[model samples]
Target chain A: MHTSGSRIVRVGTSLAVPVRRRALVQGLAVVAALVAVGIATLTLGGLGIAPERLPAALIDIPGGSEGFVLKRLRGPRFVVAVATGAALGISGALFQTVTRNPLGSPDVIGLTAGAGAGAAAASLLLPGAVSVPAGAMLGAAGATVVVFVSTGRGFSSPSRLIIAGIGVSAMAVAFTQYVVMLQSRDQAAVLHAYLTGSLSARSWQNAAVIGGALAVLLPAAIALGRRLHLIEMGDELADALGGKAEQTRVWSIVVAIALSAAAVSVAGPIAFVSLTAPQITKRLSRTPGANVVLSALTGAFILAAADLCAQQVPVVEDLPVGVLTAGIGGLYLGYLLVREWKKGTV
Target chain B: MLVGSVLLLGAAVLAGLALGSNPIPLPEVIAALSGGGDAYTRTVVESRIPRTLQGLLVGACLALSGVLVQGITRNPLGDPGLLGVNIGASASVVTATAFFGLGGHATIWAALPGAFLAVGVVSLIGSGRGGATPVRLVLAGAVVSAVLSAYIQAMTLSLPDVFGSYRYWVVGSLAGGDTDTLLGVLPFAVAGLVLAVLMAAPLNALALGDTTAATLGANTTAIRIGGMLSATLLCAAATASAGPIAFIGLAVPHIVRALVGNDHRWQVPLGLVLGPVLLLTADVLGRVIARPQEIMVGVVTAFVGAPALLLAVRRMRAGT
Candidate 1:
């Protein structure tokens, strides 16, 4: 039942399960990196917290400047970044699995663009009628449907899906620009910052929403991962292997879309993390069947690290985290493309 | 067909002049153009002249560049904006303005080399062992554009002064074009156009695949390199003058192809004439669409062009 690189562990004959050694090791390493990033994020900033006092700051609500800085400012932003990043990671893994293409992450497939358009319209057009997050979720769902329908052959044709997504993204972006044009220059600037995905001034509610989304969808994503792997073997082969391929694909897409929408709603369509996280996780673990948990951990680490850099980098300090991710993750994607093309794998 | 396109271009130019937030009558527009209008009408007409010229130049450059790109790459979806050229120009302009303190016309020069660099990288990355396929080129373009956009965004966000001007420019508009910008980019546009027209016949040879093209006495390597260089120049010039307008380069070539069949000769000239027509029409539409508010031409073009892009994607055979 297990592949060459993985070993089966058995407590008894009936309880055998295959585990990938490298994936386990790399997953732990990613977790450790996440812890380090979290600590750095918590400690190093304009208000420097001593490493030893970080634990007490996390636990207590002392009525002082230190407490306010930790409990109010950095804490929630950190939580949102981690949770949003993890959601994006899991969402990306699901998308890559369902489409059978590494480049089919939600951001690349128009989910973020739709969410951005929705958020822009809701915030500007309706004003107080609907919350930005709710608008974003609606937009993401709408975009998913449009892309699916536009693909003509569904997820079976990954290329058409990606191209159709690009077309959808173009329209969505144009709509957002039209909305931005309606505002005054200063208002447009503020909207521009928000559209690029800023984490500045995030509250606890943002963290809670993304956290809840991850909690609700993470299990579904994991449960569907095995089936998605089967689906990648083609619909007939998957069905012959006793898996309902199309059903599994649809369900995986639903979970992925929900997770991505949740992240976009809170973070305003942060770029590139979703596209890169799963690929990075796959490369690191070297075991290739939708390493969902490891991908989530890797994503959390990347966003946390990116946010920390955004805060700490002097000349470019306080940059929207999305811009930073686009710079780094885009370069990484470019490298991946070059390498993939060189190997004739693309 | 070329004469009809030219006539259409004339009509578009007239419409662009006559229509705007402050709509001037056709007679007034003609009088103003001939330096015989009232002071207020003269000022309005004079201000719009640079914008119109920019629209025309940018449109022509983008269209010719699109023709060259599509012909050279043998890709139906080839476009300067889609191939990272516009963003390359934009990132260059931002860098020159922010880091080097280059302003106004100087950044136009900076944009050309930046565009060249970007197109060079994209072609290198895209070609691989099998030459540049549509999917690979498009993906490379997307990734390079993302990286460059991030750089531009970072620079603009960090520097408020750059942000003030960069925001409007990034959205792709003709509103900010002045006589100096039009003059600055005109030479580059003219040179790129000449190169493109000259390369069109070779591109036809290239359409038959490299080996066959070489045996037919066409230097495929020279054609590709010259065509790319021409495209970069056109893209840089257009982006410099009009701030990276999309879809003109993408949609114009396809429209020309539909009209003129597969001959690069007819496609190039037709695209040259029709490019400005499409751009001027989009620009005019933008002026009228939001009234005094003024939607940028880039926004209008994107709205108009997305459907065309979708159509192109749909027509593409599977496996690309």
Candidate 2:
């Protein structure tokens, strides 16, 4: 709960700047670190392109092996990872702030599980009838509606929302498994990769879909970020401050769902990125409220770095990036829980 | 209530044998049971006998462990699966297969040690300065489960050959196991059940909180350790025989508690019987729902168990 005091610079009647210099510097540093990791992800692989040539290789024509690897393989995968990570990061920040729960990510709240179930049903049950993304969206929306209606208290009570989410997640995962069981071996293999969130063989189209969704959703999230901070002061106070807490909450959730569904559809349901990204950003930036933009950058860095490790790690080459994130996230969650316990919160 | 549970269990077992991909007449099933039926009937009965036995042992062990866990932790949501025992066993088995090149049959042995290791870690981490609160225990278990499951996924995905077997084993079933596997794990299950029965009185005392239990002349730490050990043993044996089944442990105790108060004596026995009944019924339902294609019992239990979990949460919230 440490809050670095902000210096308020009063402009003319309508504008004001409340700046925290230290947090701003930290955020910039994180972004710079992310760029470094992005460069490493692009350059350090089996092909071993130098950092200097990676820029040209990415934009160059389709001729040599290096160009082929950059444009067709590594470039799209990296873009998809960045886009997916950003979407998950923003989504995590939105839900965590709106619910005022550190654990209130799409994965914890059952949205990812719902999206997985949707994708499974689409791919396994309906086959080619519906695209994976559409089915995922439908499923994510369905799960959100169910959770919203069933909890009755909305997102006010963190524990209740978490419990309901756990139940819903279990059922959704079971449904997905049942669908997988129903499919043939080959089809099940394909669905399995999607179920466990992978970036292997990702195309530019995959990157574009998530990128397009983020193009629309991230701006809305950023605009709502101030209101989200106000809502943290309780609904009554937020209302008195001219912030429509209810509307802001609902809009924040909608934006979160859109971002989460888009990310899941493109890269399946990557675990822990959404949950850890926002929390890490909040701590790193030393911000009083959810650091949405910084969280997006952190998430992009984490996922991209994890993807790089998954691909280039000697013993476990081409491992699904989700596995690495889930492993790391699980440890991070354990740490968070112990910290919460020591703080007497849990 | 005990009589009713026993009768329901009997009926469920009977239904499990009578209904399957190939249904047999009651007389023929009975004849097969009495060792007088034709080869076809005997074959069907024989295959089902092992599966039925597995279901009974696994279900009973899971339920007893669930009761013990809920009682000791004083957490309504406490279950062997939720506490990371099942995941630990699954992860151990996967690790054994991938690294040690162990055959599938030896997985149960690997599972026992792994389950204990996970349970120990969860208990240690969950216990804060004040003690392990319900929330801490559940959260610790969840975190541990997630970590282990990630490892499992990493291993399975890396080794496609392992994935082929791991997927089916992870889902948990009683179908593939034979009489020998059932016999092999029965001792551990029986020993665990006996230990659970022995600890029921201590558990009853422990439910009154550690201070009150100590005043009642109970060694709270000893009781807790014993309870945890027995629960871990039962869970490992069940998980080793049948992959990781969800909800039986979480839902059954609640259902049993609702039926016959929370006295460990009544709750323990009734849960033991009712556990198998619920599982067998779910297994039968799985078989019936998909005529030619069979759904795993684990999937059916999740569908049934999650609603029960939601209800439990509602009731807990309301009661509090």
Tell me the tens digit of each residue's lDDT in model 1 across A1-346. Answer: 4766688889977776678878878888988988888888878866857788878767775668778777788889889999999998998898887776656788767899998888888878787898877787788889888887777666556566766776788778777876765667676677678778878778998899899988888988888887777776778999999879868877887788889888888898888788788877876676667778988998898888888888888866878998988877778767877887778864
Each model: TM-score of chain B? 0.88, 0.92
List of chain A TM-scores, every candidate = 0.90, 0.86
lDDT of 2 by residue, B230-302 (tens): 9988988899888888668877887888788879988898999999998898888888888877888988887
> Judged by lDDT against the true structure, how good is candidate 2?
0.81
The TM-scores of all predictions, comma-separated, are: 0.81, 0.81
**Candidate 2 structure quality by residue, lDDT tens digits, A287-306:** 76767788888788778888
| B141-253 per-residue lDDT for model 1 (tens digits) | 76787788888877766677777666666678888888888888788889998999899888889899888988999877678778888998898899877777767887787
Instruction: Report the CA-based lDDT of candidate 1 relative to the real structure.
Output: 0.81
Report each candidate's C-alpha RMSD, comma-separated, in the order given.
4.8, 4.7
lDDT for B62 (candidate 1): 89
CAPRI class assigned to model 2: acceptable
